[model samples]
Target: MSQDLLFQLNGVSKSFVKGKEEISIFSDLNLTIERGDFVAIMGPSGSGKTTLLNMLGGVDQPSGGEVSFDGARVDNLSESALTRWRAHNIGFIFQFYNLMPMLNAARNVELPLLLTKLSKAQRRKNVETALALVGLSDRAKHMPSEMSGGQQQRVAIARAIVSDPKLLLCDEPTGDLDRTTADEILEMLQLLNRDHGKTIVMVTHDPAAAKYANRTLHLDKGKFVQRELVA
Candidate 1:
């Protein structure tokens, strides 16, 4: 595999056993994601978009075939190993800002660093840097409930990046925000990819949200139906 390739899903398949029936979601699906690239995945409900994202992040494994990250096989890892790998290599953003209401912005952002061996002072420095990057430095002391939707999402983004993960897997990151705020968040994501070299894979249903990415792919009925390149 090329060093530039961040993710590869080769002949991947997934299925669930529903009351004696084996329901297949996808079969022989293949994908490749390169470093520093921003890609958006659009699909209808039950089309396996989120499943594919989870597979990429090692949150879920393919029932068949290979899932590789940075040239290493991820699908075969044990749960403990996968957890450690995800902590170091994957940052995740969700439609809802999954922040702990009791924790302030800085503390929320610092949660990821607690998994590492970094000192308290270093962790605080990293948290400050992340909050600053997301333009939330001034709101670091605020609780989640105290901030606007957009600001809370920014804090979530800060938390995601605080660990300096190699990949960001976002699932409808701006889905809960208003149009203007969504655009602001999208532009921030664009800046992350363009200027900060953060490779991002976002799954969104909205066409406008997909436009922010450099490349977009549509999935339907467990297969990629079309792909578009954004200028």
Candidate 2:
């Protein structure tokens, strides 16, 4: 927890009780993510990529070790405090575009603001700007069913970024798209990383997707096995 580090995980470990057995996901895992770094986590199925992402985002707690963000221990925060902290600090993008079917694109993107104290006009302005950033200005009024898979995902990205969060966590962001659409999404993510200086930690199985990241951390059997820097 310093100005240079956005996240610091020291000897983090998580375990779950599966019936009568204990399943350990991570043990003594240490990691540090600097501000504005675009990192990709790659691992085989069940290697705990998602588990680590969840831990970083404050959705899950480590059974041991420490997780600190911006000099504060996140793992020790209360559930209510973590919820509030996540609203102001963290954004999440999932494999499926989790948009409300009843709301239009702009409204869906604005949903996060409801938790804030911003005025209606301010919320609308932020939503418009975020949609424009993702090149979806014209599609703001479209429903989820009215758009293509890629467009829906773009709306999801807009929603994630609308809060202007310092950190973005993505889990298989392009998992449900075609090759061309997935490439377009990856390019947009790269722009966010390079141009906007957003700290991104993404989990992906595709090597092509990993190429866009500044660094790739590979996990094996719940441990860091390899680290590669592209470019």
Candidate 3:
């Protein structure tokens, strides 16, 4: 692995036991993502895009080889250790806006702080700043049902970034939205990547959405087949 790489997967492989058969998703896969890179992984259904993202985010372990992050071997960490490490270093954005139905926007964004040692004032400040960053400051008190789908997704984005994690993994971030709403969310994510220098890895099937990334990696049959750098 190069010294400057933020993520390195060398000869990585993943498999699952289904019934009486062992299904292999990836074999001898290798990849590297540098700091501040906004990369999109595009693949057809069943191509293991989400699985790869989960592995990179420390949500799942590779069956063979190594997955390292910032010089640390994350694939070897214990489940409890990996959970703590991920909470501190990784932010995950899913297709569905996974917000607490009972919590308001601000309180939802503050959920991650419960794992931290920050005081109440500090947590509140962080939540406020994150909401403002996503342009949802005015909706801080709104419940999930009170907002549009786009607005709720923005709140989810705010919650993801409130802890200021080093890496952001997004899986189909705009999947549930209409074109216009999806475009707005993409623009916000691009701003976060370019302006704030957050390292982002997004998995999407939409070419238009992938255009926002600095590079698009095409995966076929669980292997990276091609890569395109877009200006």
Residue-level lDDT tens digits of model 1 in 80-188:
9999999999999989989999999999999999999999999999999999999999999999999999999999999999999999999999999999999999999
Supply candidate 2's per-residue lDDT for 47. Answer: 98
- Per candidate, the number of residue pairs that clash is 0, 0, 0
> Which has the higher lDDT value, candidate number 1 or candidate number 3?
1
- The per-model lDDT (C-alpha) reads 0.94, 0.94, 0.93
lDDT of candidate 1 vs native? Answer: 0.94
lDDT of 3 at 71: 93
What lDDT is obtained when candidate 2 is compared to the true structure? 0.94
Top candidate when judged by TM-score against the true structure = 1
Model 2 residue 149 CA deviation in Å:
0.9
Off by over 4 Å in 1: none
Q: TM-score of each candidate?
A: 0.99, 0.98, 0.98
Worst lDDT window (10 residues) for model 1? 1-10
Per-residue CA lDDT of model 3 for 1-231, tens digit only, reads: 565589999999999999999999999999999989999999999999999999998888999999989998899999999999999999888898898999999999999888999999999999999999999999999999999989999998998899999899999999999999999999999999999989999999999999999999999898999988985
Extract clashing residue pairs from model 2: none
